[model samples]
Target chain A: MSAVERIPILKIGDVLLASIQVDLQDRDVLALQEDLAEKITATGAHGVVLDISAVDIVDSFIGRMFATIAATSRLFDAHTVVVGMRPAVAITLVELGLTLGEVRTALDLEKGLAILAELGERAPR
Target chain B: MTAAREDIPIAADEDVVRVRQIVRSFAQRAKLSLVDQTKLVTATSELARNTLTYGGGGAAVVELLGEGRRQGVRASFQDSGPGIPDTALALTDGWTSGRGMGLGLSGARRLVDEFDLDTEVGRGTTVTVVKWSR
Candidate 1:
């Protein structure tokens, strides 16, 4: 068994960037969901960029985790953007009939931050 | 060279993760492309989850195959639990008896090069799949 790993959540400006760099266990993902929600409230962040660029695959459980995070972030009025999904993962997600539940998607982390910025600018403060 | 076979237990969530990591190393050692590796690992993850959640825990057998110019990997998930009453319906997209998207079986079929399912009510169930190197 591997040691517990916590995905880091970095705050940049008003956007929170969370990059999933390791192959997360189910418990790690569940822990992350809880951690991210708390971070949003603690930091008062407005947007979240979840960069999964290094992720090679996503089962339905992980897919549901992303949706839950996005939905929870919405409760705090924080926009969530998923970034860097590989082509094969995308295809598999579609086959799984998981649209990621209305979570926004971008091609890369740069674009993800850009989208979050745009979302931040358009919303009324 | 013929590859060795391994049997991994899928008794819990951590076991499922363990299976994924083991299959990943196997895929890498088999020289499967990144895309193929991802697909195989993803499919194995889903099946392992099913074995744990629905099958009351089971075992996954991983095998590496090479015959002449053809080479690939095969994984079989076996469970001794209440079998699916309707295999066809279970294979249908968007159909699930439990709380899930029901993509575990059908979606896994799409990712692999070959798929075989064996089940008997009150007996057990086994799903065997193979991914040919591409």
Candidate 2:
């Protein structure tokens, strides 16, 4: 088996940006959740943006990972917005009945950043 | 009729990724639309993970089908683990016996053109799915 890959999380202002650039394995998704949680705590960031344009496929596990990440981040006072979901992926997720459950989504990175910024402004200090 | 066939072992998480890749290739070869390819690959990913996690590791067989005007891709996941005792419950959405959201089986059924599940308690399980180009 190949080594589990980690998705890099970059901090821009108060929001953390994680662009998924590889075909993620199940272990990788789990690891990313763990890492993102740690990073959220360490950085004390208020928002998270996940870029999934490169992700061409998503099953229930991957779909759940998005919702799980959002739910987990909320506990740490961080909001997560998924961005750049391919049109085909969106359709497939719908057909699979995985709605991603209340996770905010945007069309791209810039738009995702905009949503995070808006959310950040509304968050109580 | 199947023009080509390949078998892959589903022992770990990485194997699930491999299954997606193989299924995508077969889907592409069958000339499935991009959306169809994505759906089929996604379904394969769910089934492959089920084979590894619930089925205690098994094998996945991918086939490229060509029949008259219908070109398609088919994948069958088979395992010898403790078979699902209640297939009806297992097929219900959000009824997971594990960490998953329970969408694997039910959701996969919606993504493909055909879905078949065969299981027996203490025996084994096999799930076959196919998606034809439209």
User: Clashing residue pairs in candidate 2, if any?
Assistant: none
Score each candidate by Cα lDDT.
0.87, 0.92
For A6-96, candidate 2 gives per-residue lDDT tens digits of 8999998889889999999888999999999999999999999999999999888888899999999999998999999999999998898
lDDT of 1 by residue, A31-106 (tens): 9999999999999999988888898889988988888999999999899999999997887677556678869999
Candidate closest to the true structure, highest lDDT = 2
Error of 1 at B41 (Å): 1.0
Q: Model 2 misses residue A106 by how many Å?
A: 0.2
lDDT tens digits, residue span B1-134, model 1? 43478889888778888889878877877778888888889889989888888899999999888867767889999999998889999898888777457788998998889999999998888999888777
Which candidate tops DockQ? 2
Task: Please give the lDDT score for candidate 1.
Answer: 0.87
Q: Give the TM-score of chain A in candidate 2.
A: 0.97
